[model samples]
Target chain A: MRITCPHCGERDHREFYYKGHALALERPSPDAGEAAWDDYVHQRENPAGVTRDLWYHEGGCGAWVVVSRNTLTHEVLGTQAASEARA
Target chain B: MGNLVAKSPCKGLLPLSVGAMSASEVETGAMTMLSPRKGQDGALDEAMRAVHGLGYPAPSGVESAGEARAIWFGHSSVLLVGAEPGQRLEEHGVLVDQSDAWAVVRLDGPGAEDVLARLVPVDVRLCAFPVGSTARSKIGHMSGSVTRVGEASFWLMVFRSMAETLVHDLKSAMEAVAARG
Candidate 1:
């Protein structure tokens, strides 16, 4: 998939790194205890079709990007900052 | 070594720390990372814009932290050339010391564009890929970004581990182009 890094020009997909899931996991507040943060850190729905994923351009600038893609085809639907996606 | 083989474009002098490596036959070159303050988009952008405004064409893409054209070398690193003179990191973003962690290479030659054509899907024809533009795509299974540096020269950012693989493919492609001629 060709990603036009708002910073670097499109090169090859190998330049960037794949960081799964762009949406930050929500954990219960401090009082929520271990189960909360544990689920947040370890659990992920690995859904197919349309999904929000985190991808880091490890090969390029190394920015964490929130990219929406199709799990089946690996087609990148759109990409933005992970922070913006949550908002 | 004291004299800048190529004067610093933005800074009056290339830091003594700044140096370049040349590709044996492919006319390729590499420069170690320097002053790449990661996340410090403000400083990076300001400096790069200053350089661009000074007249050299720098088209930055990272806008959030004010970084416009400088190439993001990787997650925490970026090509400083994209930043300009007045830019500084204190105001915004973060800088990571990525020196020795990765390698930088310049790819150019008479048939450089033709060579890239075999690897990248982007249009490498002079009229399309023209200088100053960049894109993130793939060269085989390896992913990276390509930045136009000169008439036949381009900046290719890849992981250090992949440097040998990339250079080999690039040199092979160049040879193939020459063979086709």
Candidate 2:
């Protein structure tokens, strides 16, 4: 698999470290309750189709990138810098 | 202070030639890392131009003015090579001395591209990675930077501690390419 890093251009997947789900960026408030914390920490959709996830470009430009891809086909739909994506 | 001497990272390990290719340790004088402050990108570029007569390089680009070269290090960072950071540059960004932090080696010859191709995953052919192009990639499991400096020459830099490993890897690849002749 190849991941197109926004700063480094397309590179082999070996250069990046996959961090599960883009939802990791959204953190629930401390007073949001136990169920919310549990869902945020332990739950995942595990869908079969398109998914957005975080990847650290460990061997390249050292950017955290949000990669949108189809889980079944492993085809990358698009990628954006985590900073820009968050904005 | 006690008497001390500075030794190059690749001391006695470089200036090696295998067939038509050669690798040598380069004297990278006073490397400085420049990282712009928040919302100071324009100011930093202006300072760089004023001080070094060169602007901050674009992503994966290298800009040179006389002996000074600005290499795109990573996101929002640049490495100034062969020159000292001026005081004016400090107003817009942080400048850290990095001269002793890296080992720079120059690979030159007809087989230079072929030797690097064996270790790095990037396409380093002249057509793909022309002169003044740079890339941060894995060099035989070690994260390093490769910059095309000439038509048949490249500058490769790795952590100072990895000098031996880098030379070993390059030597092996150089020998393999030579054996094919």
Candidate 3:
């Protein structure tokens, strides 16, 4: 897997570490119920199709990237800086 | 500051000359890491320009004016080498002293690229890396900041704690490249 870091350009996948789903960036509200918090904290959907995930470019640009990829084929569709994704 | 005795992180192991390539520790007088405060990039740029006659470099690029060189490290951050020590841009963002945090080394010679290709995964070819281009990349399992300072020279900065490891890795790679010649 190759990643095109926005800052560092294209680099090998060994430079990055998959940090799970991009949804992890959204946290549950402080006053939300236990079930809501539990679902937010522990629940994960094993979608085999296109999924948006987060990856850390630890060895490259140190940028948190949101990668759009297919879980089944492992084909990366696209990527963008996570900060820009949040914006 | 006058009481502090400067020390090279690589000690006496650097300034190595081997075959067509040579490696030496670079004495960067003063260095600072600058990060613009949220929504204050314009202000930071203006201030930096006033100080150094140049603004922060673009991604993977370098900007220099007089004795100061600004190399882009990541988004909205730059490493300013030769910046006046104790200088601060408090109103614009954060300024931290980085002179003692990194080990700066220079590798130059016709075969410098050959040696680097054996270690780093980045494309160090003259056409790819070009002079003034910089990148944060890994060198033998260690994170490092690499910048092309000249047509045949590169400056590499790694954590101070990893200086010895970097020297070992560089020597091994240089030796292998020389042996193959």
Candidate 4:
């Protein structure tokens, strides 16, 4: 697989590490209940279709990226810098 | 106070024969990493231009004037070589001393691209990489930042700790390419 990094352009997938879903970026409020925190930590919707996931360009630009892709076909629809995605 | 001496990471390995290509360490004094603070990219770019007469390069771009060059490191960061990153940029971002953190090497010769192709996965061809283009990619097993500086010339930077390994890898690749000729 090849990932098109915003800063590095198209690079081999070996250069990146999948960091689970992008939803992991959202954390529960400090005062939220245990159930809320638990859900945030353990709950993951492993949807087989299109999903937004996070990947780390550890071997390349060292930027965190949000990749919108199809889980089944491995088709990447788009990508954005994690900072920009969060913003 | 007593004086201190400078030592290169590729001390004995440099100037070594690598077939048609030669790998030499670059002494880039005062290398700095600049990352713009929140909502300050414009100000930082302006400050950089005012101080060094060079603007921050766009993504995957390299801007060089004389011996000084600015490499786009990531979305919000740049690596400044040759010229010192001025203090004014501090107001807009953080300045980091990277001179010792990275090892810079210049691979030059007619076989430079051939040698690199064996180790790097990116397309190093002139039409694909082009002069003044930079990218972060893997060189062998280590992460590297590569820039096409001139025809058949490339500037590669890797973590300081991996300098020796990188030199060895490049040498081996060069030798293999040379053997094919």
> Which candidate achieves the best lDDT against the true structure?
2
Give per-residue CA lDDT, model 2, range B79-107, as digits (tens). 99999999999999999999999999999
Number of the top DockQ candidate: 2
TM-score of 1: 0.58
Tens digits of lDDT, candidate 2, A2-55: 888888899999999989899967889999999999999999999899999999
The positional error of residue B86 in candidate 3, measured at the CA in angstroms, is 7.9
Q: Write the per-residue lDDT of candidate 1 for residues B1-181, one digit (tens) a residue.
A: 4865642121221111111222331212222232434445455556544444422123432222233234534434444443333433434444443333343456666677777888876676668766666655566456766767667777665555776676667666766677776
DockQ of each two-chain model: 0.40, 0.82, 0.80, 0.80
State each model's CA lDDT, in order.
Answer: 0.54, 0.94, 0.88, 0.87
Q: Which ten residues in a row have the lowest lDDT in candidate 3 chain B?
A: B82-91
Residue B181 CA displacement from its true place in model 2, Å: 0.7
Where does candidate 4 stray beyond 4 Å?
Answer: B1-4
Query: What are the root-mean-square deviations of the candidates from the true structure over C-alphas?
Result: 8.5, 1.2, 2.1, 1.7
Q: Distance (Å) between predicted and true CA of A62, model 2? A: 0.4
Task: Give all TM-scores, in the order shown.
Answer: 0.58, 0.97, 0.95, 0.94
Fnat, 2 decimals, each candidate: 0.53, 0.69, 0.72, 0.92
Local accuracy of candidate 1 as per-residue lDDT tens digits, A57-87: 6654556677777889988777775545555
Task: State in Å the error of residue B179, model 3.
Answer: 1.2
